[model samples]
Target chain A: MVTVTKPLSSTDSPYQSRGLLSTLRRSPLTLLTHLSVIVIVVMWTLPTAGLLISSLRDKEQLAVSGWWTSLSPSTQRLMVRSVPPDAQLEEGGRYVLRGKVSDDQALQVLAFGWSSREPAAYAVGDVAQMRKGQTLSISSNGEYELSSPEPFSGARGKRLFYTAKIPPRFGLDNYREVLTTGGIGQSFINSLTVTIPATVIPILIAAFAAYALSWMAMPGRGLLIALIVGLLVVPLQMSLIPLLRMYNQIGSTFGVDAKSYLGIWLAHTGFGLPLAIYLLRNYIANLPKEIIESARVDGANDFEIFTRIILPLSFPALASFAIFQFLWVWNDLLVATVFLGTGEQQMVLTARLREMLGSYGGNWEVLTASAFVSMAVPLLVFFSLQRYLVRGLLSGSVK
Target chain B: MTHLLSSLVIMLLGVAACGFYFVFSNWLLLRIFPVRRVSLQQQAVNIQRAALIRPWLFLAPALGFLGLYLVYPVVESVRLSLFDRGGDAFVGVANYRWLFASEEFQESLLNNLLWLLVVPACSTFLGLVIAAMTDKVRWGNIAKSLVFMPMAISFIGASIIWKFIYEYRGEGSEQIGLLNAVVEYLGGTAQPWITLHFWNNLFLMVILVWIQTGFAMVILSAALRGIPEETVEAAVLDGANGVQIFFKIMIPQIWSTIAVVWTTITITVLKVFDIVLAMTNGQWKTQVLANMMYDWMFRGGGDFGRGAAIAVIIMVAVIPVMIWNIRQANAQMEGR
Candidate 1:
């Protein structure tokens, strides 16, 4: 049998001892590996990064430009109506019309013109000769002046067009809007409601079951374990229809709503149990048998030993399962859509995000913010408890 | 706000009730056959009997949920599949016949097959390559974390992210989507990606691949690290190049793990619904079995028979994998 050992580090490899020439020869391959890994990391990370960046961008810029371009000042062609002719005053014997082209102080004008046909006909601060001996000039800071040798005659303000560089704007407006008017805040609470009980209940139930399956000398234990392993892959599709019918039947019989929090929570627990039992059993079984035997010898009952001994000892496994259940329930759409009500009050984050995807299909500002809001909790749980999460996955599958 | 508060209270009550059952049942069991009150000879027998009943008490709630949520529905779904749309009448094999003959079912089946073929293979391959590559680098952990990050985001959210990338615009306009922007930059026209027939299926598959590759990498990386150092030392001493060592030595050693990752992804691929639903809702022939099953469940008020039929089809596809898992588990238990 091959024995597991510390993975061989590149520096310790025999070939590295052959001297600088061989190391030099391998440098390009090392460089290629690093380059490819960076490319892969960027490719993997860019989409979510885009979502996050887009969510914080000013809604108008988010609509007009890509998130990657959000770091740079983008050029925009804008038209603003100058104050009506009544507001023009005589200055140095010239009836002048003066106004800032835009309220945004960050906007820097690159060019300006009076007519649409030549929107950027003149450079910043260059005087453009207009009709009737009127002269128009725009400064880089979006101030424009139209001076006429004669009095300005138009009753309506002249429509002046200018090309300006809009500085990149970022804010929390999208998140604010989505959380309030877009109904994501309600859904966030709903997700927590569904996830917490659904996550906690199964761990309690599955821990006892896993303990029983592991240590107890019971008949059909092997068969029971195998059944659970088989149940692990049973497509949740099979459960949706019959369970829906059952829930409706029971609801009608009891004069209660067919779709309710209790129902979905129960559904999540049931669906999550097989894996929970399987994972916890793998852990609980491997625990040294001595502790439990010693506890029993001290006259402790099975429940006492379990509560005092197994539960505390299995903290890592419990944590692993908790993270798994939390992520799964929080990220679940198919189960939530089927089992929970879709009212504003009952809609979970994933389901709400789906509805937003349909209703706010083209509104990237809304979509990006809502997606990130929904992703926030799971991502936080993932990054912080990532060690336990990875431990759970490795134990769940690899062993 | 009141509704959320009430639900929180109810959830705490439920947790308390679960705790009470365990404590109460165990307490009652000991009270019924009081070890201190009985004769010493009878006490030994009582303890033996209580032990026999104790496992059942521990197993009760889990078994109830498994039966109600998983096992019963499976059997009932098959029964429902044999009935009419409302499940009011017995219509043996009729829904099955309809399932076999329907054009939509054929489309979904074809799409599911393509998904089954593509998603698992791509995810596992990319994961294995990333796993192998990351192991040699100093900043591997951080790179691995970024790749694994998508595994946290919901499929619906990922679809939105990808949708933004695949966003399109009319010609002579600025393309805001990354894909279209890149395409436009390369002097190629941007096409609406998810509406293209047949090819759209591949586009949807890419999302699942992106999410699942991280999972495959995590599992396979552990397997790669588990390879005995002597094997690689022998390979290196034999003058094998990096690629040869990877394929010939590293992969063969981790073959079982690769199978585990591949099959796990295959199961995930079969259940993929939210991506299709949020992306195209199975438009443009991107229909898949899971999404089709969800559609039939509620389409036209409801069709329980047809919905269950589709679910059964998905279940049937999973049975082989189920059997393999059971056998592997049984073998492990026996070895223990």
Candidate 2:
């Protein structure tokens, strides 16, 4: 095997053909490997890219053509009717019918046909002869007039088939509609109400707990740590029914609504505690022991030491957990749906998005824009503070 | 806008209250036990008392929340599973029996099994491959970042993204969904992928795999980088090829990390409710445990016993991971 690999030495390798004089020596396998990685990246990003592009495309065009063809003008075959029989008036010794063939939107008429079988048979502005003694005329701008020697008498308008070249239009109308009219705007505020406190409240509580777990000597610290770690993997589904019941009972006793912003904040705080404490404790414990020692020597109590020393020192960990909690609470649907009010005043963004999914499942424009709106914050957090996010992931998993 | 202002004010007040509690409580503790003013013996006693009391004070809020949110609910759920739908009468094992007998529950269990088997395996495998390949090329960080971008997306948002890709148009129309478009381009009839029987589950799993592979990649990529380079050099000296070195050298070193990523994704798969709830609403054989639990919770005036029982089932499914996590934490603590 070693002798057989002698000719494949790195210096003589065919893949390193980028320099010169090795045109025939280039390895297709290496090229293929690089191409495959590119393929994977494209595959991963294509779906979101589709959503973004489709969201921006004109809703009319979005319905028919794929987003891949979003840049090109879309061609649509439409059937519109001329003026009804009653609208027909005698003009120039012929009974005439007239109306605009297209809707209010500016559309360039590419072709027109009197028959459905050949929808685009006649070029724009070409008037076709009808089998009946009538002449048809259509303009590229979608205006049409039909004249017949015989007086037209029908209750329904005459059907005219045409192909229109709709320019590729893009706008934020979808987002505007969803935000202004879809109640997502209200839900955005509600999401903030849920996320801000839910993110901040836990850090304080967990910081205190983490300090105790990390430094303060207590009985059963190991068991407590173990328990919390085990709780880390306890599925959140386990807590829902009981917590809902508890909230309902408490709300009844207090004569208040159970699904309030405060309720979700507390619920989030509770559910987020285990991971927060676990991560923060891990970091706080790893702090150089000498700092806490020095503070102790200076007559600082545990509280002072924790606040003055450990809290500031654990900024990275705090930021890490804060982002984690923020994203978790922001992206949470099940918890928000269960604990928060579903009314227009209290529905969070995720719940709002899910509602949109049910009500407007077929409307891609609405779904994509609303989904993107909900995703915007987390994506911003992910991109802006990716260092801390990645660091948290590394510490959480690889530790 | 008024809502925004009020929420902001409430947030500030809440934060202020938390700060005040910590400061005032710590101040109270110090006042109650003045270590400096006492005699040496009394000071030591004060210090000990303060030390003992301080930890509890520090741990109180977190423990309270954890107890209320996690521990209490867990106990309450167990109690609830024994009670009737109204949670009034004791009904032992009836919910479990119903769960076992219901074809919907059985289908959900099978689907959960399929999700468990496929999502973690596919995500980890693809993650490993991408992590390894991306490490070799320039612009790898950007590629990794783009791939990891999905990690930040909500599962609901991700379902919408994938939903657009799975959008179906009738035959002879221009196929808009990417999957169907590609299928049509490749000379195959477009399939409404998410609605297909027995395979729609896999189609949904693809979205999760797409989302989670980045997670696995990031963790595994870090683990791969942590592997000492000397080992790979030695493997090369031993005549190991690229594939052999990867399988024999690098993977063995990061095997535990792989397990961590796998189990992490597994836990996520077990609790994945949003994707299914949004995608198909547990229809067409796509119901998983968590969504089914949610359905039972509020389907018709709510069925507490059945809901809690379903939760218990999910909890039971997660027990192995919980045990492993505890063992791992204990081991880490011991090592420290």
Candidate 3:
């Protein structure tokens, strides 16, 4: 038994180690988890990818094929027919000539064969021998000549082999098209017009409300907060028609039209206010009670406390909510559509994305590339301002 | 001279009264802040009247704005619910009577009930699972952020994203939607997913769930992290295994937080319109109350009474959940 005991050594540790990819492969569960991450990323990004690949290919190819097909080598068959017998070439006792259908258009020939059915199994300079001392030699580009003791009845053509160059992946063309011809550029501008004021007006109103709600000892202050909190759950859907009618009524009264940018902006501001105030108030109320107390002790007014102390500390919340409201308003379509118009002057980017999807359903390239173009700003904003969304942004604002 | 002077004085007084609202609300905000003013401190023996009038002053503009927009709509919805399409005749409870009487409204009501039940519950459950699973991983933040990224997208964008996933093409045509492509790949005939009635409603609900799960996960993940170490340790000392500890200690402690999350998502689920609109246009029995109300009032040639009736019903359904949520939120705030 003692003799059968195995020796232990540092090099013989039971753990498997693959160095670089060790974490990736260790446990079956980890592998699955890693795979899940890959899957989720793929799941999230695949449609976008399909949209992109579809956009770049020719419309017929997109319609007939899957984007995944583009990953594999594409093949095509053509009947050369000796380039018409009158044009057959003669060179150095042999007929030879070469020209492409187009000037270096990406694809190059692969293996080619002579049989009509076996299109890619033969090559250039192959001779087709016939009876009575007859022969026909064909070049890669359907150039051929026949020298025979007996006349040839049919023109000869040879299949060829040359690897085609698929062009480099500079996929910016779809993006360019989306920007220029897709009307997304104008929609981009429209979205900005709707979003900027929609964002600013809320912050402006909410900041003031937040200050009052957080600090003011008004009558029914608790009740007011309660009512606002109660209002938070009121579905905006409930108000859509009434708001529109009200807008129509007010507009008619003021001689303003039914659907102006002003109407949409005000509508968005009203919609965004509850959440804005709630978020801002939560952050503001959490501020160090001492700070506001000290500010009050220092003889500053509530407005001054808001401007000087509370606002500075609440920057992260403001930024986070701003990103929220901005992204919300920027990506809004329904309000803009019902309140605005389909006219080029009023269409938002989201409305434009919808139109593209509606009209060009099979046009994957336009949709994906255009959608990504629309997402560009929001993604930038989220990534840039996300650092401010740290865990402690609300800490020390109040205790 | 007397008549002209009296008229000018009344006009001036009216203008002053109008101007005072802004000053008043501002003063009210000032008074609540409780900051010590040097001017006031110097005259501490004589408390200025400005301090007494502030909150009323500060609250006026906000209240006015709230009254004009937020409060007005809510009241008008309840009032409008009782009237006819034209809002000309007053008929008490007739709209409610019709809402309960109509099968279309009933169907919408049922869909909304399903939406309220399924969207939040599924989203929150999935979110909890994701947050729980991802929390143990090294790249949890990245995972959470990637998931939460959908929450950042507007309902419209998310709806469009899912539309591509649920997109349908006819027989022999190539499937553009990822889901349909998978079906074709698996040798199964492609399905028009959004036309599948009950399941299609779920399919539409999925977009809302997808967007919201991230929100639930982030908030719940934070709540999970906020849980006290000692409580967990004590439960561990009592020999609670991981599952027991999670169920007994962690979940119970985080119950309020979970409630807050659940209620927030529930409220969002109640208001969900964009996803349903973007995906199916509320066709094929996928209409929820909000979208149905929208269609009735705004799109289907404008039936204000029915729309407002639906709106009130939605509000009635949501208020209890909203109250519970605010209570929990305030409790958590006070607890902190």
Candidate 4:
């Protein structure tokens, strides 16, 4: 029995390794998991990828061809007029009309035909026979020579149809156009204007509030905390009408524009406060109480202890909230549309994108480029400081 | 350029103003209290007074902003909902009555409910699946980051991305929109996706779900990682397979986090406006509450009463979740 067991164990070792290899190869669940993840990742990624790719594509190509086809030279059918009859001159023995079908120099003529029915019937560099003993030769360079036994006589030159292989052209022309002409350049500035003060002021106000709510022995502190929590989900729609009226009243009282940058900044600061205070307070409250207590016992005032210690210790929380407010205020469309004027001077990036959606809906080149310009800063902020963002989310939501 | 510079200056001024308030108020409190060289009894009184005054001082700016912004708006929105379009006359529930009677409001309500039902559930479910699957993989962080990347995109930007995906040309034209291109490639005729009535709402909701799935995944992934290894070991010892461990042990442990994710996404869906505004603009029967409120706010010189009423409806829908959130916070505070 001992001998049999020893042999069995020895045999099982080799079989076990082979079995593990086979299982790894044959695991349908693992394969399915990987495939599904790939599919999801692709689905999640393709939209933005399309946007980026489409933004760089030539405007004409973007209109006609799918962005997927932007890399390959797109085949297009075209009709070009030969040199007018007056330009035809006797060359050697036959009357010849010589000119380039396309003068742009970007299009490479692939084929040519005299009739519209079969525009690409004759390959480029081939002489095609015409009705009246005429011969038309077109080259890959788009130069064409039309010769006829009889002198070419007409008010207009012969209509030549050819297929051209237009090269794939990609550039920053779309961005240049959108920025200089599409009004996004101005909106980009407006977005920053709204975002900067909106982001900074809220942190200052909320940090103090958070410090007070968390560490101070204030009466009604519990009530304020609960109030902030409740206000966390208050839809911004609830505030627009009232705030608009208030701003209008103040503007009329002072004879200033109702939707100035200051009003919108205050509006954003107001809208962003509850979450700011809540997230910061939660983080500030969780600080090791011994530090504050020891500082207090050392005769440091609450103000001194907060400024000298708690503020510095709460850097991560502060950074996280800053990223949050920056993204929130930057991406905000509803608040901007309502509080900021829709005029060119005050429109923010999101608002500009929305307006462009209506006016430039069909122009994907403009739309994609403009959208990316607006999204660039946030995406930069997101990728660079995503850790803080995730940290903010984790602390702000679950706790 | 001048606009940009002025805004920077304003931002610095705002910061300086806040700093001045905090520093000056604290200085005044300290000077009045004089904790450094006072009688012991006087020091005690001074410290008490400063303690009482300092919290309010620290709290004053935030409270002032919150009061003027959130609390005041909520109260004033309720009042405005009862006023006329001009906001001068008392209408007294006339707007609410009109809202109940209007076909557009009903459509918006139904669509909002549809969005609330689908967006959060879909986003949370997708987020859960991704979080669960991405775990124990080498490239999980990269995959998770790609998924979460959409959360950084503005809704308007997302709408343009999706609008291009849904773009349609006439029959036989090469389908440029990705959806239509796929359909054509699969031997199906291209259909204008966002113009279809019932499905358009789903199309719009997909944008939200796409943006929100990453958020859900990150939060849920963190929660999933937090599951104790011993629980899985205990289950494995009981002869439970991977699926059983996942279903019974893992999901149950992270249930609260899932709830947190679901509720958060639900709140975002309630504010669904930009996508609808940009996509179909309430056309094709795709109006939601937020967009409808925005429309009424400005349609034909504006209807503040009806708009505020819609805003109030949105606020009312959020009240339950708000209560649940506060209760959750209170419970956690108790644990602390």
Interface RMSD of each: 3.1, 5.7, 12.4, 7.8
* Tens digit of per-residue lDDT, candidate 2, span B4-49: 6776777778778778888888889889988777799998888888
User: Which candidate tops lDDT?
Assistant: 1
Error of 3 at A68 (Å): 4.5
Residue A235, model 1: lDDT of 95
Best by DockQ: 1
Q: Per-residue alpha-carbon lDDT of model 2 for A14-117, expressed as tens digits?
A: 23434432432365545566788899999999888899998888898899999999998899989987878998889889999888987757699988889888
Q: Rate the local accuracy (lDDT) of all candidates.
A: 0.89, 0.87, 0.67, 0.88
What TM-score does model 2 achieve against the real structure? 0.94
Candidate 1, residues A175-252, lDDT tens digits: the string is 999888988999999999899888988998999999999999889899999899988989999999988988999999
Order of quality (lDDT): 1, 4, 2, 3
Residue B315, model 4, lDDT: 96
At residue A150, candidate 4 shows an lDDT of: 88
When 1 and 2 are scored with DockQ, the better candidate is 1
DockQ of 4: 0.56
Task: Assess every candidate by TM-score.
Answer: 0.93, 0.94, 0.78, 0.94
Error of 2 at A209 (Å): 0.8
Prediction 1 global C-alpha lDDT = 0.89
lDDT of 3 at A55: 61
lDDT of 4 at A297: 91
Model 4, residue B256: distance off in Å is 1.1
Positional deviation of residue B220's Cα in model 3 after best superposition, in angstroms:
1.2
